[model samples]
Target: MTTALDTTDRRARQVRQALWIGFALQLAVALVPLIDLVTFDSITEHVRAAYPDWSADDVALDRNAITWSLVGIGALGCVGWLIALALAKRPTASRITVTALFALGLVTSLTLLSMGGEGYDLVVPLAHGLFTLLPLLAGLTAVVAVWQRRR
Candidate 1:
């Protein structure tokens, strides 16, 4: 038989685990962009190979824009994740973080969809989309779990 205190402690543990999962998802989101930036040359080379008519200057310009955009987004994600980590002990603040992550995911998805076929190849775009989506799902789950346990 579980007492109210036992149930509360169990729920608290679940929330903490969920929050950690959220942090990990955000960390992955943050790293993906940084990885893209670091591997820009390789990626561009592949892109150029795919489209033989694209000039080096054109590829460089496009790659630059994409890399910078990714860095900016990733930086924001890192900050948000860090804040969420800091707020793990505060359920309300943690819920806010989840909300923020959902917003970020929506924005990223819209931007990517609007870009169409211009910037990156299919794989990069798909990967970015997945990165955003996975974190959003994690955030949503954590938020729901936290909400259910609110007293």
Candidate 2:
């Protein structure tokens, strides 16, 4: 019953919704702790438990670094999300914003992977994986959706 125009409109709406959900989910992960019990205990607690050989002090130190890094990562994503939300109507800005997010995601992913368990089940490494991949995925999705919209 839908015309091509209707279908295209639907697709555009879906793309916007995807960006919104991605933005919200990412913002929650970066800005809030203890949501869905995804707190400091989420991954680090596991690593700390598995590595009794290290002091609680060692775990605490690493936790600080991870937390701050995630915060920075989250801030950049937030900016990109805002840009996408505001300028999705404008393909040029949307593309640039999404590209920035993708670059940031790439750097974060590689650095986290490199830092994983060089000395330690690498259990906490899971956090690094999540932190690395989530934004990367979101960014990639944003870029693709916007590019498609331009067509």
Candidate 3:
């Protein structure tokens, strides 16, 4: 009997696929945080009316953090994202970068919420952040292990 392919190679190929998928997920979220800038002020006004305890400073700080995060992490992480797909032999580095980027995304999201954003409750945004985080952590570790073994 003959196998269709090398199991190890097939696994590496799977790892490659996962790496790309994780990259894709993060890519998709590139716009999630931006919604704040366009709608935050209006939302915060309503929130303030509904909940008097909410502060104006919270809105600006949250808005600024999330917006900055969208720009910085979303933009800067592109290189790492490309590397995850394009690197022939540096999947480890790619994965590490991907992990870091996802982590950054999560932190950014948390920062946006914790800093106090009356614009919106963090439940939805935090949910999205978790979705992005899972793949990044899992795929990055897999990619790194595979690359390390490959070498």
Candidate 4:
């Protein structure tokens, strides 16, 4: 039969597994921005199509800014995931940290997504925007797993 200690251990193991999965998801999403940075010509085309009136230099500047911003944000998210993983043994701390990070990530993604006129346009390519939002899935999973009740 299962005792309280057994349940606690099982939950901790579940939380650890979820944290690892979240880290993997965060890493994968982070790489998407790096890929975008490497193949930036596609980003330039998208930016030019979105803003036809912009000059070549303007397009280049905008593409660079968007790509770099995504890369930076992705890196930050990966770091946050690592921190959450480290705190997994401390259930309260881990849950709070993961939940806070998830909220911050969600806000940042929404803000990035609403970067154009009327606050409803994607500043980056649709794929980039979607990729940026992908880490939230990881964050959500981690948050849920960490906060699961002792049942």
The prediction achieving the highest TM-score against the true structure is 4
TM-scores of the candidates are 0.70, 0.65, 0.52, 0.85
* 1-151 per-residue lDDT for model 4 (tens digits): 8887888788778777776776677677667766766766677777878888889998889888877887787778788888887888898898889899889989988877766742226676777777677767767777777788876
Model 2 regions more than 4 Å off: 1-12, 31-54, 116-124, 149-151
Candidate 1, position 92, lDDT: 74
Per-residue lDDT value at 143 in model 3? 46
Return the top candidate by lDDT: 4
- For every candidate, C-alpha RMSD to the true structure in Å: 3.6, 4.1, 5.7, 2.3
The per-residue C-alpha lDDT of model 3 at residue 86 equals 69
Name the better of 2 and 3 by lDDT: 2
Off by over 4 Å in 1: 34-54, 117-124
> What overall lDDT goes with each candidate model?
0.65, 0.63, 0.54, 0.77
| Residue pairs whose backbone atoms clash in candidate 3 | none
Clashes of 3: 0
User: Pairing residues by index, what is the TM-score of model 4?
Assistant: 0.85
Q: Of models 2 and 4, which has the larger lDDT?
A: 4
Model 2 over residues 54-76: C-alpha lDDT tens digits? 78788767666656666666677
Writing each residue's lDDT as its tens digit, candidate 3 over 1-151 gives 4344465466567666766766665565565556645755443443455456757786556446545665566555555556655653455565565456556655755564454344455523444445445445545554454544421
Question: Of 1 and 2, which scores higher on lDDT?
Answer: 1
User: Model 3: residues >4 Å from true position, as ranges?
Assistant: 1-5, 36-62, 90-125, 128-131, 137-141, 144-151
For model 3, what is the error of residue 135's alpha carbon versus the real structure, in angstroms, after optimal superposition?
Answer: 3.6
How close to the true structure is residue 4 of candidate 1, measured as C-alpha lDDT?
74
Candidate 3 local distance difference test against the native = 0.54
